[model samples]
Target: MKTKVLGLCAASLLICAAPVATFAQPVAPTPPPHVRESIYVPVRDGTKLAVNIYRPAENGRAATGKRPVIFVFTPYRARYRETDGKVVEAALNDQLALASLIRAGYVVAVADIRGKGASFGHRRGFQDRTEARDGYDLVEWLARRPFSDGKVGMIGCSYLGGTTFHTASTAPPSLKAVFIGASDLDKYDFVRAGGITAQFNTRPDEPPSVDLASLPVDGDEEGTQLRAAVAEHAANTPMAPLWYGMPNRDSVSPLTGNAFWQEAGVYAYMDAIKRAGIATYFWGNLKDEPTGQTLFGATNLGSKFLAGPGSHCVPPQGFDFTGEVVRYFDHYLKGVDNGIDREPRATYWLEGSNGYVRSDQLPGVESRPLPWFLTGGKAGRQLGAAPGVAGTAAFTVDYKLPPAEYFGFWPQPMDKHGLSFTSRPVTAPMTLVGFPVAHLTVTSTSPDADLFVYLDQIDAKGKAEVISFGRLKLSHRKLAEAPYKNFGLPWHSGLTKDLLPLAPGEKAAVSMTLTPVSRIVPAGARLRFTIAGADPRQRNLKDIQITPPPRIGVLHGGRDPSRIELPLAR
Candidate 1:
């Protein structure tokens, strides 16, 4: 969590400092103060984006010469500070990393997207076309500025990381490179994994604030300027609040502007980015933990789940995060001839081994496919074996039951509300490095059912560790043939397509994708696959409300072999 400022001696080499914890008070060599200023940069539609520029300064004056600009566009009001020993709380002031970048002799510009902050415009949600174009305009403007060296790169985490993705999609000429870490690329996939609205998605939204006091303005001069800007904005025009999440499929409409429901509907515009071929440096966490504040950046291990070209690890451990950023920017923006790009395209952290595995391609392309068929037997014996006989497992959803009591963990009291299948203990190590898919035959008495599939690893002592899970609305189960995208993962055209409801007792094939994982199941470990009418764990969060069928059934064995596929790396 600590920021390590590295000096750029040569455009290509970084003089890195020892890694330090950001919030944990360490003796960090304070670099020269950076001169901070705010300006409004107008975009194509006459809308101005409020940008805060931080340039390296000495003796209260701008430093000599120009430097490549690291532009960060965020909607989450840039003012930020370390909250606990692990997290950062955001408000308005300036990007916490601005000083670090400036001290490193790089110009840093953090801008609020077109609709937020002191910027003038209707603030739309994430990845708005206008926001992306504003980035292109801001980059070109920064490149043309006297303090800029005509090379610009975008940097940040979470919201800013998302903006970087969209901006790259625009393929602006001045955007030379980008460094992104842990941002959700696909809005639909992230918001509605398994066709269920994520608890994080339902957060209440923050409205656009044009007031100068809304920003983290410091000192008399900056305060006076901010007041003047606020007055001018008011003299010319005016503004609104947004909801962060939707309860059901139909509740997503009212939040078209400045909200998650509308903003996250589209897929990540990676096609244009790939075509533009800008130097890209990206990484993500293998697992997304819904904790503390709402920072919507979770990488579905299945979506574009690659390793070496970039790297991903389980967060709060393993890597030196800030060091990685410095190394990447030094190579690309600083023109450092570091062998980063030449390194493996994918690197994954092995959970149990506490070591990293590198490969040229994720899933290795040549990796073996391990398929385990769903069989008819006892509830715990529902996985593996041949389809000798057909059987069905049923579960009921009771709306009267409180979310807490219904969805609480282990030796779960609600086991009667769902069905689980456990696999035999692995005699040796088993490594799965890619996406997992479930081919299920389902029948529900209700018109639709929200399906949640969980994968857990149980040790010899029977401690179950939830590894990954995926969901799909039975009605939104239809798949599209974007075969090239995400490879084997099932793609659902959510909200956009018709919701084909299921009839009473109608047996349908449900192709479900369990969230991708790259973990080692050690010896004597058992893999448990669980299916439920609703995911109680998420339901207990209060944000996620489940309105599933009274009862749902999973059919296994017989001619219609319901199976789950795992990608076993060599």
Candidate 2:
């Protein structure tokens, strides 16, 4: 199941966390009847990308028929070995996925992206233009191979999945389709969500070190050499001491650093893919691990790091990830005439429910804006019906303290540091399918302050589950004109040119749209809108040294009524 969230992230952030889904069990299979070969495929720049091909074999010999190709591009070494000098098997190297396609009479080619594996080049990061071009070259090369038909299809998850879309953007003639499971579509926003860095970005999963001399020459020689080079690079460029390391981390391409917002630069070319009109499949989860991230999106990229329910480290048992890919490839590459393309471009998992909802657009439901007013008190407030009478509430925040000290789920924890508004218990089930928005009238004592809001569902038992979160550095409150808008969503470019400082002590209107969420607020459950000066609990929370003035005030129920609007599905 897939879900969606708002876009963009902070300048200095680190990202981490991967989620796993439960897979359905499959019958035991015989040894793979395929011929495996390790070869180097050259790109336009003369750099060779290490590739391992699996071609169907009949009776221990290569099959004679030409077949559609399934190409997978990955930075995570298409082939590698363990420290004990044992050659990693397909199951360990994602070869099991290829076996499924091979059995179905298709050829699978897994390539080590340039600079990562035996492929020669410098690593640029995810969706680099060079990588995209490399994909184009690889696809064309595969199409012309003796064992391949003219059609080529791509499939992968995460980095591999990113390459699928990047390659498709070039509109490779031989590239007929792309299937992305979970990938970083909105690269920049995901790394630094809402101008705050994601916590995962800080701790990256570095590859295991390999001994160049001890490597087995009989194994993938190029892969062995590549691992050795990577190890050497790591040794020479050891990470800086914890606090002095690069503030911003890039998962795909780690150049020294990039202009903060340009992380999603790869997406600038998505229009080409859309115009190419290739059959595309996107699989995302509404609830995945490492909170606030999303798995996939067709065009306007969806949320990047969402906190879903699954563990990314373990693959779900029983479910066949390959079966679904084969179905997609069969229809697009082999012309099997399946109704795959006729289906909606997206399939999202509805949170709080077991089944999925398909739609040509996100959210998949019609919704109306429901506004809740913030009324009463300097210490706390109730999220009741829009007040017919006006009221004002003031809360003080000590910005000098660590955000962790201020982090709290319930209203009481925020009693001295922040303020909140709560709704009455729901009498019926309500599903929120789009971005939740909050419009506030505020005055700050300092030039700037950050607003962190959490939209949570408190059950009849009082246990709280954070559904979605939103943040805005007060200076970045200015909204940009978006190319596309859904559910009256507000857009921010996060560009330096658009940033405006808050006028001290003057009332200013600020409107923020929290991340998109899809959940059924069960009966007898209450909806809570909690606000704080800082969010210490955010997965990517960083102590950016941003200390708002001693106090921040929120004015409500007058000409400028402070209220939050929830998008409830009708």
For each candidate, the alpha-carbon lDDT, in order, equals 0.58, 0.60
Question: Model 1's lDDT to the true fold?
Answer: 0.58
Report the lDDT tens digits of candidate 1 across residue range 66-129.
Answer: 8989888876554432333222222112222444566678888878775555566654554667
C-alpha TM-score for every candidate: 0.77, 0.78
**Residue-level lDDT tens digits of model 2 in 362-446:** 5523657788887775544778776535765666654533454222322223333477778889887776766678988777777
Highest lDDT against the true fold, candidate = 2
Which RMSD values do the candidates have, in order? 8.1, 8.0
Error of model 1, residue 265, in angstroms:
6.6
Provide the lDDT at 390 for model 2: 70
The reply for model 1, stretches above 4 Å from the true place, is 1-33, 58-61, 80-100, 207-271, 289-316, 376-380, 398-417, 495-498, 536-548
Error of 1 at 248 (Å): 11
